[model samples]
Target: MCGIVGAIAERNVTGILVEGLKRLEYRGYDSSGIAVLDSGAIHRVRRVGRVAAMEEAALAENTNGQLGIGHTRWATHGGVTEPNAHPHVSGELIAVVHNGIIENHDHKRDELKGQGYAFTSQTDTEVIAHLVHRHYVQDQDLFAAVQRAVKELEGAYAIAVIARDNPDLLVVARMGCPLLIGVGEGENFVASDVSAVLSSTRRVMYLEEGDVARITRESVQVFDGTGAAVERKLHLSDVSLASLELGPYSHFMQKEIHEQPRALSDTIEQILAQGFGASLFDGDASILQGVKSVQIIACGTSFYAGSVARYWVESLTGLPCAVEIASEYRYREAVASPDNLIVTISQSGETLDTMEALKYAKSLGQNRTLSICNVRESALPRFSAAVFYTKAGAEIGVASTKAFTTQLVALFALTVTLAKLNGRLTPEAEAGYLDALRHLPGSVQHALNLEPQIKAWSDRFAAKDHALFLGRGVHYPIAMEGALKLKEITYIHAEAYPAGELKHGPLALVDENMPVVVIAPNDALLEKVKSNMQEVRARGGEIFVFADLDSHFHDSEGVHVIRTPRHVGILSPIVHAVPVQLLAYHTALSRGTDVDKPRNLAKSVTVE
Candidate 1:
């Protein structure tokens, strides 16, 4: 995903656009560029590296304009070069910065070339500038030109356009990608993320699919797909700039790991503040009463969170639950039932595969949809029938930490609420569950305290080439998340298997060099998991156990133990996920890898 920001202000906005791009650099850092409409002409500058370089180039060129747009790209359509950077210009009339892909770009490029429009870069985004130029030549209106050009394209996109004639206006549009307008006094801003414009404005309007906005210094007018004027509410962003800064930590990942206590508390407190009698689902409770089963569709870390929810939903609600990888779920001819509840989880809320999967489910007449997500105004929440906002704040790290744990908190709340509505949970059990949930913040803080010990264990993993993570029952998904974090950040080969699945195939890869990291929560199958650890130890596999302090699993020659503070049964996944994240962060730090950006990774997977 690329980060885009646009600002139309009375004063020169070169520094404003540069600062916004810096805030959004976490979304993409491969290349950066800026375009401005100044003195009846469009000025553009591009760089192949960080936003700092792009800012330097802009300053050297003395780029300045009241209306402008900027982009930090992760490079999908072309190589990471100055030519492939965003703010592509068509002639000297139009400039465009885009995020997401244009699926029909090749066909459009061929047609545009037939019309004698020359292309400069290998990006699908270049077609937009030329297409807009074509429309502008016909109608001579920039706003109408953007609408006419978008109708000719396909796939996801959020774009900002600036034209030489319209020096005071910034036209923006979104289709299946995130875009929002930030409201400021006598000035306005647009960006792919709220954090990008937080320094300028706190009030924002999230644009829906096919929504276009014409932003000027004094006014913002939004129009829907049918050419009808639409009204959008402005929400005050609670995120402060301080939350985005690395105050006392070495990295954003480390800051976010410590922020877990507050993030989890905020998510759970949203429920606890409503009191135990309030409905956890923000919508009607009747929707839960008729649910017979559930289908969870997600990708990456969110999928693992859904996998953890599968164990809880099946056990607590007495319902069949299935988890599907979103990309695969959209392609297959899976049966959809009216009695099934479809749940989608995503941190960014604009994940392409998960969004497409939910749309596919809706196409099959499945309307009972719910979203567990961090952004309240994101596509997933807007499309779902019920919304559970995680309130985890901004997670800028490429490898997720707080978002995963907060998703589990929301999913756990959903599971318990459904259980109560289904007549499966007793009054006493409901009270106990709520009590435990109220203490989730304290429990997460206790887990954060174990970071020192986990960091010590990370030293053993820093030098390893391969590792294995093991768990049983509900914690099996936790093990998968653990292995995923390690592999994602450290570049280490890692695998996760259910303790029972070790003998089936994976035992052969174990040896003295391979570290076996086991999630030994003291659940009912602790004995079986302990025996599974013995199997690994018997094979000269060094065992690194992250077990409950009460599990009585002690350290010996080949076995290393890192005890976590005991937590409530259902919330164990949230607590256990903390140590796993720490281990990965510390291991990555030990290996001197970039924990925030990671290699070849972006924060949001807006493109498929």
Candidate 2:
């Protein structure tokens, strides 16, 4: 989840790199640094705090270089310190910034030390600079040296290497992580994501695994590992400052929570339209013809979205869907087959665990992998046999909102496609569902209006120390996601209990000091959730409910109701998510957190 940026320009590029890092500041980090090649010398500086501190240090040093690389690091390999910060250089032959881990670094470190390669820092990234330096001294070509060095690496990494020997060039490579090369009129750029190089260029070449590139001021050279020149298609990416902005909101979480309406609307547009244009949205029926099982792999909020999607896929398409937490899937050694349809979900598409799981599943015999990601030209999409792009735009907040809603909408589209393919859904059923899905935007908009209602009830939970989140069926995972959001940002003690599980043991924790925030959407399981709410109310616990008007849910002095738009049972999770998002947002705002850049949490987890 570190951010990396590199630039090769006719004039100084350090300022541009710094500005680009600022655009990526939403990606959490503890330290920031940059290394620029100036006058055949490597100039490096870093600070031990936020990106702003590093910017101040950059100005103080007056470092000027036309070719440079920068990194914002959330420490994993070593402690957060100036020495451990990125742009690690050894002997000035090579300077490197890295994201991800080197699992066998200690063995490699011992070997390199035996070879008389000294290091100044204790980072696995420092080993990269030394490894590159050793190869650069032998090959003299930075690109070849990087390729040879990367071939020896054992773990995940997206590395940017700069050399003083070649003042006008930089080398970039990616394996098990994301790296994009930006092509400009007279300059070229590389970054972990589009935000890092959006200031310099909009045209980018997303590097595939084992692909290496040498970037210069006037051109970019793509190469295969065997020293053959390769052609790369320029993928125009939708990355811009306007999408990254928080707009009228004070926190990005708030902006995202409100944007759920349009986010769902945008996703449902092409999916639910006239005719048989269901699957692939453009009427590509091939997506639904496969006879197989669906394996959903994801982490964090995206994982909750997957859990909710599994219910819909099984309900509508009559297909068995299994959802797994990406981090644990490989360890469990799950089985795969030719008819195995694996689907990976991620907002950034660069999530380390999910990416690894997707690759592992795709490589196992005959399996077709599909990715539902918001990022276009992302690593996961490139790796998948098929891709479904979610138009969630840029979700800057660490706590996801719009991305979750859009992913659900995308899954709904897939379910419809599958039903259409199997002849399971008649025209009447399809038309009604599609029409309801089309009006989902208006429903989400109605739900968004309840922000003020939620805030008014926010004071009721302000004095409470712990909260109980309860839901049934599909809403159960929404409860989990809500609890996660509350705890992640507010540092509050929260727990999610499936409504039916409340009386099993969690009932003992209920008291006036506990706020039971029930996801009581009016569905078949409404009575179960309502019973759970009553169970808490009997113990004098405050009841905060998110429900539809038809539940006829009464609002008492101790019971506060947050209304939701009436939608399908499966899609309710996506709509019900907005209020919980607001609850977490207001709770965190009350506690004063850097919502956009949460501490110790990166937007994308690029390592296990």
Candidate 3:
């Protein structure tokens, strides 16, 4: 996912454009560029580095314009080079900043070559500039021109077009990728995320697929591809400026890893405070009653969350459930038995592959889908039959830590609701589970306090070449998430192995230089994970274990034990995930990688 922003502001405003790019940098950071419209022309500058570096370059070059579009690119079509950078200009006719891919570019490029249009950049995006210019030549209507150009193309794209001829008007459109129009006092804004414009203005409009926006300094209007004006309202978000602050942490990963306790507090706050979970869960149970089968679809960390949730759903509700990787699941044709339910999970709720998979499942006409998401206006909730919102406020980390933990908490609520509906859970068992779920916020707070110790351990292992994380049962997802967190920020090669599989191929990698992290919280699989830990320890691999306080793990030599609360079954991953997040955060901090905006990673993957 690439970050994009377009502003037709009131003053000479390259400064505001850079500010927008900084806010949107969480989307992508391979390269940054901005093109400002000044004196009836486009003044453009781009560089391969952080947004700050690009900002310095822009200042040095003294580029100025009242209106322009900026982009922080994650390369898809071409290499990470200036040519592949966005803010692509076509002969002073049109400059386009694009996110998502135009799949038919190869054929379109060939066709353009026959028309004597030479290409400068090796990107699918350059074709759009030419196409827009061609349409503008014929229709001479900027809105209709971009519309005609998009109609001729194929595949997913969200584009903002600035034409030299029509300097006052900006054309923005989206197909599968997300686009938002931010309403401000004398000007307007366009960005891939609400975060980019949140500080600028609170009132924002979400542009859905097939919606085209024509923006000016005074007014903004949205139209469909057929030139029909579409109606949408400005939605005020609860996110505040403080949520975007780094807040005395070395990295957003660390800040968010520590925020798990509070994040859980926010997520579970209302239901717990008002004693209203019965109503929410009661309604959920009625809606989900008699479902014969369940399918959970997600991607990346969300996928791992669903994978762990499968155990909770089946164990509690006795519902046969399948967890599928959303990207792969979308392409394959499958039949769903009637009344079967598909549950889609996403932190941003705009995950491209997950959205596609949900849509594909809906097309089968045999299953109803529910979206478990964090953001309210995100695409998943709009398309799904129902939505369960996870109220973890503005997660800015590219590799999710708090969001992952809180998602499990939300899924636990859903699982318990299903069990209650099916009469699978006894009153005693249900009461115990409910009480355990309520205690989880404090339990997570206790686990978060172990971060200092984990960070200390991170220092010793930062220089290590690789790491292996191991666990069993539900803890396995915690292990996978831990490894993913390490790889995301530290740039270290790490792998997660089911503790039982240690005697298999992964055990061969255990060595003095390797650090092995084990999730050995008190559970049925704790001893099994301990046995795997011993195998690694015997092979001279360094061991870091997060063990329950009651366990005799304190006597274990050669393995460092970070004591945590005793948790059983599905809830163990909640406490165990904190130390792993801390471990990755400190490792990345020690090595000096940009933790918040890790290289080649984005907070949202809007484009497939």
Candidate 4:
């Protein structure tokens, strides 16, 4: 995914474009550029690095224009070079910036080639500029030319077009991608997300699918696919620019890791205050009453949260639950029923695979859709019938920390509510669960206090090239999440397996060189996992166990134990996640890798 920002204002907009791009750096940062139309000509600057480099280049040129478009590219179509950077200009007349892929760009490129249009860069975005310029010559209207050009393109894209002839008008469109319009006094803005314009305006209009907008200094006109003028609701964004700051933490990842307690408390506070059972499905009781089963669709860290939710949902509600990877589920045939609830989980709520999976499930006559996400304005929330919005303000880290834990908290609240609705949980048990939920924040803070001990163990993890994590029952998903966090941030090779499955295959690769991480919560499977630990010890494997203080495991020569406070019964997964997050962060810091912006990974996956 790439970030696009366009500004049509009365004053100079070079600084505004640069600042907006900086706010969107979490989406993409492979390369960046800006295009400003000044004196009926496009002034462009491109760089092959972060937004800082592009800002420097733009400052060196001293470009000033009232209408402009900027992009921070993720580089899907070409390598990350100056030529591949965005703000592609055509024949000194038109400039364009785009996000998402143009699936039929090769065909369009050949046609433009035969029409005597020479290309300078190998980017799908470059073709849009030429296509618009070709149409602008015939129509002489920037809005109409952009509409005609977009009609010929295929696949997902959110594009903004600026022309030298129409220096005051900016045309932007979206299809199967996200774009929003910002409302201001004497200016208007369009960006991939609302965060880019939060400083200037809190009022925004979220453009729908297949919608196009023509924006000028004082007006914005939106049109639907049928060329009819459409009206969109202007909603106020609750996200504050103060949430984007680092505060005291050195990295966004660290700041987010410490924000888990507040995030989790905020996510479930209202539900717990009313009642997890009746208030959770307050107006939607009929939907839950008719639900025969549940299918959770998610990707990446959200997928691991779904796996944990699956265990809780089945165990509590006595209903069958299945967790499917969204990317795989959307491609294959599936069987679904009207009585099944399709739940999708995502941090950004714009994950392409997860959104497609929900649509695929809907196509199979499953209309009971529920989204557990952090953003209220994302595509998934708008598409779903019901939503549970986690209040994890803004997560900028490439590897998710607070979002995952807050999702678990919301899912756990849902699990308890469903259990009570199905007559599987008693009132006394519900009250006990609620009381524990109230205490969850304190327990999470205690876990964060274990940072010093985790940092010591990170030194050993940094020296190893590979790691193996083991767990049993609900904690198995936590192990998988831990391994994923380590691999994603530190670039270490890591794998996780159910503790019982170790004897089936994975034990053969264990030795002194491999670090075996065990998530040994003192649950029903504690003894079985302990035996698995002994199996690893028999093979001289270095054991690093994050166990409960009462699990009876003591530190020896090779068995290093970091006893987390006695784990909460059903909420143990949320408690155990803290140390896993710290281990990943400290290990990445030790390896000298980019902790906040991991290589080749963007915070949001908005395109297929």
Candidate 5:
């Protein structure tokens, strides 16, 4: 949940480092700092807030250098104070910036303290600096010192280290976290994400787990855990800096919500043009031949997406599908089978728990694996046997929007493909599904047209402290996603339940001050959801219904209705998702919360 950027260049890198941190602001951070190797010493400027303030301080101090490292830290081991900010220094010799948790920091800190190493900050990252300094004192070699120090670390981390004594070199390592080297002429860079270095280089090499590298202005050398020299392929990234910009939108969340139409269109058009087959995923159709069931694992928004897919997979393919939250699944005992297709969903594709769960599943002899993700080069896709890439394109908002919709589109395609392979789908049925898929973008755009109304409804929610979301069957997960979005950005306490389950216990929480959001698509459960809406009304709960146009919901004193376009059956979830996202966006706006970077949340959850 942190950002790291390092640069070794012929020119001054202070501005470059600051720009990189700015690009990484979407990842979310409490404090930011930069350590530049100038002349014979390392100079660091750290601030306990945004990059702008740190940059201002750096500019005032004339912080400039040919080699430097920067960090935007989301606190894990310590408080969000300047003393705990990254670019943590050790004895004025070593400077380190790290992402991910160092699990054994306590023991290491105790040992180092016994050896006269003074700890300045209550951070695990500070241990790395001291550890490197301890080794550097012995060999007087920065690279060797870092290599030796990392061997003792026990948990996930991606770190970039620079020594004041070795200004010409930068050392980096990755284990269970993402780290990549940006390939540039007469320069090179390292970042936890490609977005950080996109301005200076389009080509990058991603370091694998347990890999360490030494970078200089001219070249890079990578070594595996065993210390053998290795080669990592350089990839030409397709991400554009313009796409990461907010443009005319006030916040990235709002822009992403509005971009769903284009995002869904791009994702669907690619599969349509390719004519979905084995080519749509990693392996050929042969991989699906023996898959009789599906097991999906994911975390956060991706988990909600998986919950939606469970309904699609079972109904369309006649497969017994199960969805589990990655964090819970990884730590518990479970039954694993080779016939169960291990499907993992994530936007960043580097979600720590999901990745660990996949590894755990594979270790249990579940060889059949598939990853549905947005980034093609992320660890999940690279490690899985098959992958379906979602072309949502650089989702910078901490609370996902386009990424969630695009993932649903991908999962729907996957379900149809599996159904065809299992002989469960007739050609006529496939054609109907494809037609519905093609019209999804237009339907979502029509849903977007309801934003003015949704924004008006948000004014009512601005004063709300609690919300309840209701849906039935497949739309139930959509309700969960809606509740999640509201709480994520607006900080309003929200919960979701199947409409049938409202009377079980949630009904007691409903009152006049409570706003209940109902997803009432014109599907088989429409009548049931309407009944549930009435139940809420009986309890004096304020109801906001996002219904299909043909549902014929009327606006009453206690019931406010916002109609979406005509329902497209299987694709209704994608269309319904648009309004709820807008509701959360506008509600967050009304409450004056940071819609893009919500407090204590990072776009990518790289740590457990």
Candidate 6:
């Protein structure tokens, strides 16, 4: 993932660009840089570290300009070095900041080198700058030059370009990645995310695929790929700056962990207010009428959320369901049918693999597609026929907490809606499920109340280098998510398995030094999971059990029990997720790791 910001303003925009990069720090980057056009020349500064370091250097050098672009790079094409940072310049004529990968960069670089264009960095983005410069020399128009340059390039990319000769304009384009324009009175801005420009403007225009835009201080002109001018609807963004701020909590992860109650309540209440029909999604309930089977595709935390939905859809509607990782699903030759509802889940709708997977399914005639996403303006919602937006506002943490739980709430709603449409859910059962959904916020609050006890176990967990998470049935995916959170934040090697699968192979790794975390809810599979716990105990494995209040589990030597709130049956996974997130947070804290921005990971994976 990467962040891009560009601005053309009446006043000096150096501070604006730096502040915008700071707002995007949550995306995770290894280096940062900025380029500004000042008096018919391009001034550039790049640093191979945090934005703070680049900002300090920019301020010390008094780098100020009325037109500029900035970038925070997550290092895909090249290693972390100053020369590899963004705002890559070519012949002092063009400077570019890009968000996505350029697949044909190597070939493009070879061709550009043949033309006698010197290269300074080993980045796919540097090729963009050189290509733009090559075209600019012929047309002498920044907008037209960028348009001509992109025609030769291939891959997912959102780029912002600035020219030394054309100081009054900035050109931006988007293909598979996301790019938006922020509108102001005497200023215009472009960014990969709304948060980066939230302070300067609340109104924005999101560019569609293959659309290129010429932005100036006074006006914005958007043109499609065919050199024809077009209009893009401007939206008044509802995201407040306060939602992005860390108020009482020490970290964004901690704040997001506690914000789950409100997030679930808002998502559920919005649906309840809408009266829970097909109208809850983008297309009405008729989209579900012909759906015979469900195929869910996603990546990372969203994939696990889809995995949980697999259990719900199969049990509730008797519809066979399958969940696949988006990256793998996009490449494999899978069967697609019109009756198979293709569902894609993503916290940010711009996840490249998931977006491509949805497109691949649509290309194969699986047109009954739906997207569950957090950002209403993201690409997935716009591409899919139906969409359900999760109300987990502004998840800043790289390891998702509120976003994942809110996704579960949204997926559950989708499942029940499908069940009702298929006549599988009786009115009584629907009412009961609705009641449980209404009480979910309170149950999540009860789960958060156990944080102190979870924190008490963090020191011990931090001392260990490996952990094993176990659960049964629906909670098995929850165990996988827990293990993912732990390893993602704490840098511990962790693995998860269905409690019953322990004897297949993983039981051989159990010992006194291994900490086995169990999800022990008092469901139908509780006895089986308990039997699995005894197997770990028989191997002298140190067991840490997060049990339901009525699970009949007690603490003993080598077997530690921390009882969570009463289980809510089908909705237990959402409740059980909070404690695991807290455990990851506390353990990462004890280990002195960055809880919000983990190493080698970006919050939104825009590239493959």
Query: Can you write out model 6's per-residue Cα lDDT over 1-608, one digit (the tens) per residue?
Result: 89999999999999999999988877656999999988779999889889999999998989989999999989898799999999999988889999998999999999999999888888999899999998899969888899999999899899999988888999999999999999999899999899999999999999999999999899999999998999999999999999999999999999999999999998999777765568888754467886899999999999999999999999998999999999999999999788999999999999999999999999998888899999977999998889998899999989999999999988999999888888888888988888899899999999999989999999999999999999999999999999999999999999999999999999999998889999999899999998999999999999999999999999998999999998888999999999999999999999999888899999999899
lDDT of 3 by residue, 1-608 (tens): 99989888777668877888888888898999998887888888999877898899999988888789999998898989988898998877789999988999999999988988889888999999999888888867888888888998888889999988787898999998888998988888898888888767888899888988899999998988677997987899777888888889766776787788788887777556543233553123344767777899999999889988999888878889899999898998776776788889999888999998988988888446788899878888888867778877888889898889889887887787777777787878766776776788888888877767877887877888798888888888889999999999899999998999989788888988888888887777667777777789888887888888876787356678888877644588887887788888888888988888887778889878
Show the colliding residue pairs in model 6.
278-285
What C-alpha lDDT values do all the predictions have? 0.90, 0.82, 0.84, 0.90, 0.92, 0.92
* Candidate 3 off by > 4 Å: 273-286, 555-557
Per-residue lDDT of 35 in model 2: 91
Report the poorest 10 consecutive residues by lDDT, candidate 2: 276-285
What is the model-wide C-alpha lDDT for candidate 2?
0.82
C-alpha positional error of residue 582 in candidate 4 after TM-score superposition, expressed in Å: 0.6
Q: How many backbone clashes does candidate 3 have?
A: 0
On lDDT, the stronger of 3 and 4 is 4
Runs in model 4 deviating more than 4 A are 281-285
Question: How would you encode candidate 5's per-residue C-alpha lDDT over 336-404 as one tens digit per residue?
Answer: 888989999999999999999999999999888999999978999988988899889999999999999
Clashes of 6: 1
Clashes (candidate 5): 0
Candidate 5 collision pairs:
none
Give the poorly placed runs of model 6, Cα more than 4 Å off. none
Determine which window of 10 residues in candidate 1 has minimal summed lDDT.
275-284
lDDT of 5 at 496: 94
TM-score of each: 0.97, 0.96, 0.96, 0.98, 0.99, 0.99
Let me know the TM-score candidate 5 reaches against the reference structure: 0.99
lDDT of 4 by residue, 1-608 (tens): 88999999998999989999999998899999999988778999999889999999888889999999999988798899998899998889899999988999999999999999998888998889999999999968989999899999998889999998887799999987889999999999999888899878999999988899999988999999878999999999999898898989999999999999899889778877788754553224456665789999999999999999999999889889999999999999898889898889999888989998998999998988888889877889888877788888899888999999999988888788778778888989888898888988888898899999999999899998999999898999999999999999999999999999998999999999999999999899999998999999999999999988788889998999988988689999999988899999999999999998888888888877
> Model 5 off-target regions past 4 Å?
283-285
Better of 2 and 6 by TM-score: 6
